[model samples]
Target: MARLKTLGSRIKESAGSRVKVVSPGSWRSGMTSSQRGYGYKWQQARERYLRDNPLCVYCERNGRTTAARIVDHIVAHRGDMALFWDETNWQSLCKPCHDSVKQAEEAAGLGG
Candidate 1:
């Protein structure tokens, strides 16, 4: 009987470099979430915004009503606090749309 290779094992076999093990308290760009301005204030603002805009804008455009779970920045902040906190730059999106479409838009430099 042939055994199926695990995804991790297959990836490791195909990839040359070992996966970097991130230590606890280690964050990308050497800055924590709070340092990135996503602290208490942002949380409170996000909650308030979500309350006011309960539906996902993208989903709504597609004629599907979905509850928004993420308050996304229409423009990439890139450490700009002004842009980060700009209410006008905010949009409510469902997890799927935010993670997939929005991420792809940002990657393609179309977002913002």
Candidate 2:
């Protein structure tokens, strides 16, 4: 118990020690992925984006609303933080359109 308490104190002391320190990697001493809300933040972002772009992107282009239920990436926003915040790369698409785009891209060897 004493040792655990000491470790906790050390971590608390080092809270902001490294700006580059990122979770899903660190938290070595003793912490869980869920202890921090790393996954939740992204979920929130997705919900917000879906609410904002609540129409099938392709359907909208054709002057209709298929009630897009998929949030797609015009250019997939992999782990790139720069594009993470860019709404331009994200579009709402119906499942069919999204799957079609993904499939076509994969066939063309342009999938990411």
Candidate 3:
């Protein structure tokens, strides 16, 4: 399994192809200034999503009782924010389950 930093790096590489990533001290060091700002806001929104909707959305949908607290993005945060606050794109998942799901999605042409 890839580590978080490795996964994040790959994600940024794939998603930020057109955008110039430019955060000098960030894992997403290639993010541009404005995009980094947006990432900041998006992270805050993600925190809100996690706080507001704890537990795994997928597990909840399947009627499971997993302890999911990590907020997930249905799309991504490469170079857009039009849907940043849209509830349709948010989800919760436990650490292991989230890792599994993310891996599957990446394998199936989706970014985690």
Candidate 4:
């Protein structure tokens, strides 16, 4: 008699069969403003801003209370060093608010 395979084992076996391969070359990836030169100082500023303002500024403005995990610049710095380090230009925002709403607004030329 043939042995039967369990559902979990069959699923695992099928999943393990597929493999993805990529060719290594000079495929450079773009870096975000924060990753380029904002580095250590930006991290420190973000931490301090979050500590002082734990709630999402955008959500608060919209009458909702959400914890902020990102320190965003009110104005997109666009490689402007002075604007990048301007504390007054910063605001605390949640991941969703920053990535979705804020990004969309900035893309549409609605945000500074």
lDDT of each: 0.88, 0.67, 0.67, 0.81
Q: State the lDDT of candidate 1 residue by residue for 8-110, as single tens digits.
A: 5443355647576544564436777898899999999999999999999999999999999999999888778999999999999999999899989977989
Model 2 lDDT tens row, 11-85: 355666766534455433244434433268756777898898888977777787788777666775545657755
Q: If scored against the real structure, what TM-score would every candidate get?
A: 0.76, 0.54, 0.53, 0.67
lDDT of 1: 0.88
lDDT of 4 by residue, 1-112 (tens): 9999765544345654756332234122265445655688888888998999999998999999999999888998766778888889899999999999998998799758
lDDT of 3 by residue, 1-112 (tens): 8767534444344554675444467445665555554467767776887777778866877789887767766776544455556678767888876779765886697863
Write the number of the candidate with greater TM-score, choosing between 3 and 4.
Answer: 4
Q: Is candidate 2 or candidate 4 better by lDDT?
A: 4
Weakest 10 consecutive residues of candidate 3 by summed lDDT = 5-14
Indicate which candidate wins on TM-score.
1
Task: Show where candidate 1 strays beyond 4 Å.
Answer: 1-28
Ranking by TM-score: 1, 4, 2, 3
Q: Looking at model 2, report the run of 10 residues with the lowest lDDT sum.
A: 29-38
- Winner by lDDT: 1
lDDT (Cα, 0-100) at 35 in candidate 2: 42
Better of 3 and 4 by lDDT: 4
